[model samples]
Target: MLIEQSPSLPTVAVVGLGKIGLTLAAVFANNGYRVFGADINKGVVKTINQGKSHIRNEPGLDHLILTAQTNKTLSATTSTSEAVARADIIVVIVPVLVDDQNNIDYQFIDGAVQNIANGLKKGSLVIFETTLPPGDTKNRFGRRIEEISGLRLGRDFHLAYSPERVYSNRILQDLKNYPKVVGGLDKRSLELASNFYKQAIGCELIEVSSLETAEFSKVAECVYRDVNIALANELAQFAEKKDVNMSEVIVASNSQPYSHLHSPGIGVGGHCIPIYPYFFINKGLNQGLTPLSRKINDNMAEYAISKIERGIESFVDKNILILGLSYRENVKEPTKSTALLLIEQLRNKKANLFVNDPQFTESEITKYGVKPISLNDKAVSTIDVVILQAFHQEYSKIDFSQFSNCKFVLDGRNKLNKDEISQLGIKYEGIGL
Candidate 1:
């Protein structure tokens, strides 16, 4: 039974109030839809209901969320049933984590679908924005929703897949600007999902053939980045052995047509790139290449540690300071951070470690088993080595001369001025230069 399009604005329920989910909720609300956001966390629900954002450092998002709340177009609740009961469209954006044994955990997504099933009305369209293994959307997710709701997938309710394709900080802009890839269980399902997104997001839609294609597309994008970054990291290692500046080579090589070389850093971080490879591995496909790319990128952290050891002759007993704890610049998220991996390895050597990041508080830093200090703290002068793991904007203002006792500085992101650091009489080592 295909539900006729509502004459009034459709109510949208967005599950999981994480970064991506919250942003999508805001997008729908801003576009004049009555939006209900559902999260299991009571604190998140309370915060959103107060017309404030739980997500940090997103430009224009706070004002957009406040506007949505003021206009009575958006609200949040801890109970998923309450949000989904009257929603004409439901969007699931819960996370799918990869375990240590390289297994994809569907616990979060499964729980969210079960909650939706409890209140799922016939003729409502359900769309998933979370990344899943190729066939998991139709096989696992669609089947589970049907079993829990006692509704046929396409006949009683429409099911679709449209993976979220936005970066962390610029989610709002990317959501409106990027082309959305949408697929569904049937033609009617695809039309409903695509038309809703077309009007709600005001973005171009790329309709694919099936749900499996949509699922694989998102994973493929992340895997491509992971492989490209691994190539850059491998080249950097070769340049390190030959005493050549790999950044210079990269700049020169990228000038040629059809060349798109990624930058080499300590390691690839963030929730998507590092974890998406596991989805492919879980299916027992791409056994050799994907896993090897992951291994190469993973080892870059150890490679950075080896560089720090070489830079400081007496590394074991030295006092070291790490400048950034977040996975990337300007974002507070530490999911799959290479800096965390580096800190873990450094702690095993029994070195006195201090960390500073403008994005995190002192309490957050303590969780990593390191002393928290400000960038301009007086203790920085006594450190033997400074590792620049992330290049936060505030870090650009720091005076490297303050580290008078520092013998070496490892630039993991190529952030420091090599010539300036050399003039300060400190040994400088960068990832590729």
Candidate 2:
């Protein structure tokens, strides 16, 4: 049963007002708990306090924030002490970034735990929603909290690891509807964390035996997708050499009940799939396959460039327009975007590159050192090649006939209709088909 709001509902302090953190804050506030959001960025804090969303393209986030603000259930602050002092539950939702060398950087989570430790109170429950490698939550985070706060685990306070499983665009619905996996240091801690989530978020609470198991489950979810995507990419490459339509093959193959293959793209992007395989490899487990998948996905941009190279005789003086700069469709986040890597490779070859994404501002597109053009601009008609990178919703409505003089349309994603574009006298090629 969903827990109804009472005067006794525990206050929630969510640190780090990033995509996940801000959404979670809104979730708790809408559920009738007082939520205090803490972030290092003053602008983000200000935006949340003003009942506006700093994150873009998230459906219904702004309205949720406004409702929370209007009801006096949500507020934000930069001071970690102020955010957690009056709260009975402190939730750490900071990011765990992967460095250039593929090593897990714990700086963000470390700083968050230290701040939470500073305001640690007796009888309060501390739950970590950040993704971590196996043993990180127990050995590193829990140890640090105990050291800094001088609190005994499961005695003075409780600790748990519950990874956030929601995607960027579907956070609110997922948080309320999805099953929440939680694990703790001991039985008492587990019970406390599980009961709180059951009443708080009103989602089905799944309990694991150890904190490490909970952490590993989250990493494994991403690794599974990454490995499957790598398989699809490998098959796509082989199909290209044989002049086979891989997308058609995939469609036929998926008709079998046991067959479930992911679609091939120019490259894997976003925060999770590109980053999570490293957590397994770094821990000295699944040494070969994990690293190999990461390498394959990472080099997919080069594979895409190879396709462009094969289609065109030369890159010199070629007018190439890349459609969609953001990592994915509709979402504005570009973290570890493969399009950025493709742009860098194209620039090295002295190709004239132009980008267009409805979600990105002109200045944002220019930061990539490429000219920003509209989808309907006259320059698009004169382009020699059009690379459809991301499948943004706006691109679906584009009139392909407008590109009157374009010679090639390299669909980085399988978004364009091959027969239709071919009939229009434009050479159409996609990643798999």
- My TM-score estimates for the predictions, one after another, are 0.96, 0.95
lDDT of 1 at 165: 98
Q: After superposition, how far is residue 140 of candidate 2 from its true place, in Å?
A: 1.4
lDDT of 1 by residue, 1-433 (tens): 0122234777999999998899889889888688889999989888888888999988888998898888777789877877888698999999998876667888888888889998899999999999999988888878888999899989999999999999988998899789999999999999999999988899999999999999999999999999999999999889888989999998999999788889999887888999998888778765777888999999988888888786665567788888889988999988888888888888888788899998999999999988999866888889998888889999887798888998888889998888888999999998878
Question: How far is 89's C-alpha from truth in model 1 (Å)?
Answer: 0.5
Per-residue alpha-carbon lDDT of candidate 2 for residues 7-29, written as tens digits (9 for 90 to 100): 66568898989988998898888
Q: Highest TM-score, which number?
A: 1
What is the clash tally of candidate 1? 0
Off by over 4 Å in 2: 1-7
Instruction: Compute the lDDT of residue 379 as modeled in candidate 1.
Output: 83
Give lDDT per model, in order: 0.88, 0.86
